[model samples]
Target: MSDVVLREPAHRVSPRAVPYWRLSAAIGDAIVAIAAVVAYVVVPGMPGWTIVLVLLVVAAAVAHVVLMPRIRYRVHRWEVTDTAVHTRSGWIGRESRIAPISRVQTVDSRQGALMRPFGLASITVTTASAAGPITVDCLDADTAREVVARLTAITAATEDDAT
Candidate 1:
């Protein structure tokens, strides 16, 4: 990290990702929170503890829906190189990763219902490293495909071919 002076992620995720992330998080949060709250209300005599728990859940949902997506959009970024994959993301506890293309095990792209409408997709690169897979979130669908293709070629070219 100290050797390379570059400060920011080489590529920021697509802007459309903000709304797409926000919507999906909000929907999941609402589904769980609303269901719990409704169940509590239907009981007629809501217990004090249940009410407090539900309220706390709602508060968490509110933050998850409102704050997280925006922060993620601002922080999330990734770059693919002939030698490595670089990424940075998260707010409370920032995380960054650098995975060499030679170690990559798999490359995949996915489109969720909400993301599809916005022409967005996420790409994940699994590697042999113990650190965990690296994800490039919220790229333009076409861009994600390009990244996958480029990374695949780079990784394949570097393979040792044990067999």
Candidate 2:
């Protein structure tokens, strides 16, 4: 028999974002809550709507409690090496990307109602091609902005160097 093990790279930086489940649960809860309210007002006397609304609320609540805390994530790292910016994402199943310092077109950040309470945000790095937009959701708002700013600066510096 043989045993094998793997370790995280020594230089890897932990992402400054909340778990995906947390975001998902919050979104689920919000939608369910709104639906519940609508059901109550529009179909309060109907047993089926009431039961469905209650079930949704219970399911969302359970997911929020049981699953959100168990999920994990890591933000993509921006190496900003001489020629490229490396962006990686994943927890159990990992996906990685590298953009030549010149290829990054824009960086954007977003915060939703659910994320607002947790003081979290998302940063999306866009390339010229539509298919290449790399989005890292669940980052802290300020941290997301800082990361974008740094990438922008790096992109600009690389452009200057190229010229």
Candidate 3:
């Protein structure tokens, strides 16, 4: 084992926890609504836009039914402990991921047009790993900003030791 120290205080879970995909669906639902109308009006034959629309709606509904249940939307919690930043997600296959406080390279937040109505943003945490970045979506914007700031500070302090 090696010695490592924490530079900042741990963050607590947010109180306004919400579904991660609710926001995505908010946008997708709008598009689906338009598609539904188009399908109702434009389908010319027995196997046409009507069938396509039904498939799309069914697909979207099925996705929501299957995935929404597995996501622990109400239980989202994240904390920046002394040694690592821990985040938990999922409802059925509940997953927990930890990034060593020192291994964190970047933390960013993104805001979309639909997210604005919900006053939310998405956060992404990146490391040197090759699997690409991990994203945490549908966070209240302020919380997203706070996470980014905390991670950025931690990164700055440890940059010199980066390989």
Candidate 4:
């Protein structure tokens, strides 16, 4: 191999992914909002601040549901190569990881109910290390499958050398 290192460009998931993220975030926030509303309604003589607090909570949740997906999409990226799997993800704290194909023990592709509607899936690449699996989320379904297949083949080739 040449001394020059290879790097992959960053990429975002499908644009349709925004709705899936929004819906999931909204659903969780709605559950919390509903419980808060029930408490306000059922409790006798609740403090006036409770009303203000609930409204602020809901506004913040709405803002998150509307905004976080775009941020997440922008930050997440993955690439699979014969030598390694590279990923960068997360918003609050960004993480970049590179797992050599020789270290990969398994690869999987999974889709949730929300992801299925948008034809999105997530790819997981597992290594023997304690750091846990690396995941590429919100990929196009076909692309996720292809990545899994390619990673599997690449890892398999290294098994003999590892032994």
In the order shown, the candidates' Cα RMSDs to the true structure are 2.7, 6.3, 6.0, 3.2
lDDT (Cα, tens digit) per residue for candidate 2, span 5-45: 53232223333344545556676777777777677768646
List lDDT for all candidates, in order.
0.86, 0.62, 0.64, 0.82
TM-score of 2: 0.55
- The estimated TM-scores of all candidates read 0.85, 0.55, 0.62, 0.88
Cα deviation of 155, candidate 2, in Å: 1.5
What candidate 3 gets wrong by more than 4 Å, as runs, is: 1-23, 30-72, 91-94
- Best candidate (score: lDDT): 1
- For residues 15-110, what per-residue lDDT tens digits would candidate 1 score against the true structure? 988888888899999999999899998988777899899999999999998998889988888888888899998866889998767778899999
Off by over 4 Å in 1: 1-6, 49-52, 159-163
* lDDT (Cα, tens digit) per residue for candidate 4, span 1-163: 6799655535667677778888989999899888888889899999999999889888988888988988877877777777778888886688888887888877888999889989999988888768899888889999888777777777777754431
Error of 3 at 112 (Å): 1.7
The residue-by-residue lDDT of candidate 3 on 1-163, one tens digit each, is 7688633323423333344355465556667766776767676664554667677786776577446633546545567644567776666565566677676777778888766766778788886667566667667788888878877777777645432
Q: Which residue pairs in candidate 2 collide? A: 15-75
Which wins on TM-score, candidate 1 or candidate 3?
1
